[model samples]
Target chain A: MFKALSVREPQPACADVEALSETPVETLLELIDKAQQPPWVGMRAASCLIQGHADAVQDTLVDWVQQEDSRGFAILVLNQIDTLPQPVAIAVATQALAGPYASDATSRIAKSTNPALLALVP
Target chain B: MFRLPFALVALILLPGCELLTGLLNGGSGMLETRTSSVQSQDGIATIDVDVSGESAFQLTATSGQLLAVEAVNAPDGSQPLYWDDWSGVNSLTSAVWLEGKDTVLNWPVRQADGNLSDGTWTVDVAVVDDQGYYTDDQVDVVLKLKDDSDLSTGTVNARIVYADGLKQDSVVTAGVQDAVTRWAEIWAPYGINLETSYEDSSFSTDQPFPGEGSEQAEVSSGANGSEITVLITETIDGSTDYYGIAGGIPGTLDYTDHALVIVSWLTNAGGDGEFSDDDIRLFGETLAHEVGHYMGLFHPVETTFDYWDALDDTDDCGGQSACESALGDNLMFPYPVCDWTSCTPQDQLTSQQAGVNQRYTGTL
Candidate 1:
């Protein structure tokens, strides 16, 4: 009359995106650039960038938009471009539209109500 | 590169599209279900499950106290089975023993011959007390069986819920629909058809995904009848990184508070506004994977590598490399096997796995 118990593994803990909010903008960018980090880490880092470092990360975001590997995360950041300052949003979208992801960039820009960003679409 | 051939091979191995076509044409529909109350006599409950020319048979026992399968004797009084005894070794007679209120047994699990041995089989059940001893208790068991003589065809209804205006967002809606189509294809081989519908809602939750809370309770309560409700949210608890999670193994088709499945739109989209081809494939696999859990399929080998499912066909492969090599393409692998470039499609379901899905009480 031996009984066996069923055992299941718990899911791994998700990376703490909130913790990265306090990280330096440079460190967040570095984290995003690290190929070893899981895609989520780069995504969380991009969120941290948009929250407070949009102006500083504009160039880097545009660079990621051009690259194949990081384009998805960069596009993710642009999805919330409305949260950034008007000037920074335009700057990033302009550079993004010039990249290989032009169509994707155009769609994200077209959704914006900002006149400056929409004018750049056509 | 290396990903293309694997993808092509997976495509070649997929069952004919006719399975889905037949379902759309109104072939064998959802399996019918019957629930019966079994009272314990001297700490054991004897119940009879009549196959009666059915394609398959599944018995799920639930009680206020924990329940376990103590014996299963066929019509000939042979193959006396014990719970979790020689499990994964004795595939035909091995039973799954879970220390919970509910346990389901699907006949012909992992049996290569697919012989259901139709007859009125007697299953003896017993309750385990708080201290893990056999105790007398009344148990309610539900039997899900396919109709008449159809062995390989069954339908599952899915109601996908869009939260935070995701359904209104055309990009998200198209991506989700594409994923659902792919999910149907993945299950086509097992003759399991996914009849999908969509819903729109706004649910705000601050808790992490899979955490039990009022918000999840409210979402799960939306499920009724035989459809499994899948709720797609913006990002679980403010992060867009985690994949989807199921409320429980075998989430109910009833109007209970714990009968929901959850997927994150942003995570499935890889945080992008639009989903790429790879994103769609991953999303489809995620949908199938999570729904598999809701239908009572466990990961062949858990992430810990030590714990394994109760199935005989799934190997107890250890370590990341070993498990990936062994069960990477399995539909219920713990996570997607991928590196810098692409992921291997996790679309394959073993016979036992398919049996488990078909045996789910919600299949109706």
Candidate 2:
């Protein structure tokens, strides 16, 4: 199946932005859908703010991390989290992101948990 | 400026002291239309607004009470953009709208206090267009009588906790923290508070001799509410077996108010590091993006629920190559591309997140 993954809320879905930069994993990360609209902006951003949709997506993409803390993974939220209990959300994402941990090149590269990786940061 | 009869204007505003009285939404500064007319037996006042598309609108009375909104259709099937519920309206939260339909929003509620309610309020609404950028409209209302939530009380509060992981100074650590902080500000208006200890600590315990460490963010919520714990790591070396993993590294874990757990890993080593950036922007996005997962959010180009059938039929990244075409050119597109010299070209936060930030922190 096809999918678009991102980090945080739709306003700045880091997943889709970094999709191009991402090293493909044999195990899929996410699927693509219409409710997400503009494709660039995920469902989260598509359902809330309508102003400067492209601009918002562009700004989020232009901003990338040179210095990274290689600890946990990132997740993309595609729904309205307000009415729902926050604790529920935290629990869901943890499991989802961790599920794909071992199938990617990064996970393979990180097998040794090498400190050299930090030095490798640009 | 489209104007109606003077009586209609008076009919709409004169009842400042009515059971429930207020505009459906603040003037977007985008467009406007005013009308005064028949406030029939429905006990609800109807204000004919001027607008076309429908997403969601929020209005605040001078009483500071929130008036939930929906853009729906009128009885005539003309599909209105606004409406008012003065007498029998219940909590505005009761509204549910269906897409692909033309309609006007119907919302208004009378607090239990008896007297009319009024105050300053900022309306958090979603344009529901392509990107869904968080948009807001602020307005003031005055009540002829004062009605309260019974206790004659009113005040809403919220909290923001930084996802746990990085320390205050380490380049990677600090970079992560700063990024989350900025995200909190963006979501403040949603009544979420942004909290960070800013203390210098690490999540990775045994980093590789020459490798960067790891970290983790754990989110928890209950009667005490929600909080994220960022766990940074110590150092380690990668000169060992291809399969032997070492000490703890930065790993992200997201859970719902306690639902699913998403564990992620990061690094900046050989094979063209995807970690670093021209700026800390990626780190910041990572913070917010990951948090979105813990919050029960999924990906945009969803392959699961069949949510992508009607799209432009392009790839996720919106680029020419398979990597780009697969994920498209947007940040939240779908795929994660790793090039030593590139970054996500179309990344950005969803609109609701912007509202979440605005509702509390009062910043972007």
Clashes of each: 0, 201
State the lDDT of candidate 2 residue by residue for B1-364, as single tens digits. Answer: 1111111100123344233332221112111122222221121223332223321122212111122233333334432223233112111122222111111121221111122123222121111222222223322221111111222111112122222343332444544555555556543534444555433332333333211222221222211112233323321221100101211111111121121122122321111122344334544444444444333222444423233311232233322354345554333343344332345544543443222222210111
- Interface RMSD over true interface Cα atoms for each candidate: 8.2, 14.6
* Candidate 2, CAPRI quality class derived from DockQ: incorrect
Which residue pairs show collisions in model 1?
Answer: none
Error of 2 at B192 (Å): 8.0
DockQ score, prediction 1:
0.13
Q: Estimate each model's TM-score.
A: 0.64, 0.30
The residue-level lDDT of candidate 1 at A95 comes to 78
lDDT (Cα, 0-100) at B293 in candidate 2: 34
